[model samples]
Target: MNSTHRKALINKLGKERYRTLINNDSFPSLPNDIKEAGLLKKQSNLDQVSHTSESKSRQISPTCAEIKSQQSSHLGAVDFASASTYEMNLESEVVQADVVHEQNPNYVSGNSLTFGDISVPISSCHPYQGFTKPDLRYPQGDDQEDSNITDAQEVFEHASLDGIAAIFKGLVCGAIRTTSPLADGLKPSKASVTTVFPPWGAVDCLLSLDICEASVEPLAAALFNATVKWAEKSLHIGFAGGASLTIPNSEVTLKGVRDEAIAQVFGSEIQQAIQQSRIRIQEMEKGKLTTDCVSMIITEKGAFISLSLGLVQGLEIQKKLYT
Candidate 1:
């Protein structure tokens, strides 16, 4: 359809999906204007307080292992400052001693396998771009001693997951401070959001949100809805999802010297692209271009989804949702 129709469709779908999202008590609440699918950003005094405390995040942690070690050692009565300083020097050396490849460009990591000297491996966790896929299969012969072989995909997935975990933990803990509807009274944390969720899409929604202004609940809930819909619909590579923001009408206006001239021009190619997406274009009234907003709401069995893009001030959801 035309850009006007396409924009209208986007506004309609965003509101509809969001409506079905927020009826649950667990989600953050928003004002009624959110029903219109207007994605505006909101700033509050609570948000500023959260930021001031976040600067000290690095000091917020005593890992479980550290706590257990301290308890086991019975060092609560001992002078920790002196003991820690001495122990830290030794531990620092041990941690630093693990470093390799400092000078040797051809150094191979223990997790990596290389053929002879050139950087090719029979099986490598790090696959070279554009090279043949690493052979992950191993012989299953029982005529001799049996040995285990690592699954390449599993190895890589685990390694990648460590990084995603750190990111998710930060997002969750940070959100607890900012948006949980009970954050200010709650103490800050130096941990991730929730691992209770699958976490497959945590990075996706977090990356889309503005950390300075965005809270954890709305985007996190959006992520949950997106993932749940992804599974329920059995969608692969994905379905129809796109969004557009409203720009000031003056953006299209020419330098009208005291109403001397006025015009609105936009790329017709965008309109052509939408029409090409198999959407019907029954009517394209020019005034509808300025109307810019419409919305729809879908309900699940005994569940409703309420979305508030406007509540997320300075929120920017990309046009394409990539798998």
Candidate 2:
């Protein structure tokens, strides 16, 4: 189909699916523009608050043998200054030890292969390249056993997105203090915003959203569309069974001028991607689900599945119902 027609089909599909999704909710749905704006605002606020309290990551502690299994709890008021920092003593003799070879260049011994000094001409061999080029095949002695013998083909593939992810993570963490908004009751500083959602709060906030369960699909569809550009080229998106989404990209590139340009150019595509991927939305009238919210199951044309709830906690509930 023509690009315009294809876009129209996508819009039609999204609207039909979204309408169906809203019908499942007891609350009415808001106009598309309004819903988008609210989500954007919430996302912005979440980003700000998340950056402020950045260190509260979930930690895993392990107990072994007879020791009691300890349930992990969030610790308050961590002692930031109590950490002990040390410098490396690179010049110490222990650190400076190196291998020494006593064999002479011209020495040729009789027991070359059986047990005595085997003098090989130095001119026939190239010099070794530092510590990394270890001669693993050298028969040292009876104690020298080949410890590792795994095939090289088993090594997993790597991607360039790894660098991109690092850069994105750094930007979010590094710029957290600057990009926050300044307004009434709050200046646009990072710390003020952080009090609400600490750093990396997006994951938590998303999980907490009580979309009617139907709109989750649209949200996933949008996010999928947004993120799939890299996956389309780098790795296969795999979905093996019931409701799973996996995008094997090194990182989601959403930062700086490059990120901004991408968003500007591909905003609609991203949104549509999310809309198209949704598979199911929970019904609201059953009262089993939350109001003014829609959860959607987004699918990747048989590749994978993810959930996307509405923009805010109860936005669909707050809007008017359209029978």
lDDT of 1 by residue, 62-150 (tens): 35345435545663332222222111111111111223333322222333332212232223422222234335799667543222221
Model 1 worst lDDT window (10 residues) = 255-264
In model 2, the Cα lDDT at residue 127 comes to 23
Q: Write the per-residue lDDT of candidate 2 for residues 10-52, one digit (tens) a residue.
A: 3554432112212325533444534544554565456445523
The TM-score that candidate 2 achieves is 0.14
Q: Identify the candidate with maximal TM-score.
A: 2
Model 1 stretches astray by more than 4 angstroms: 1-138, 141-173, 176-217, 224-323
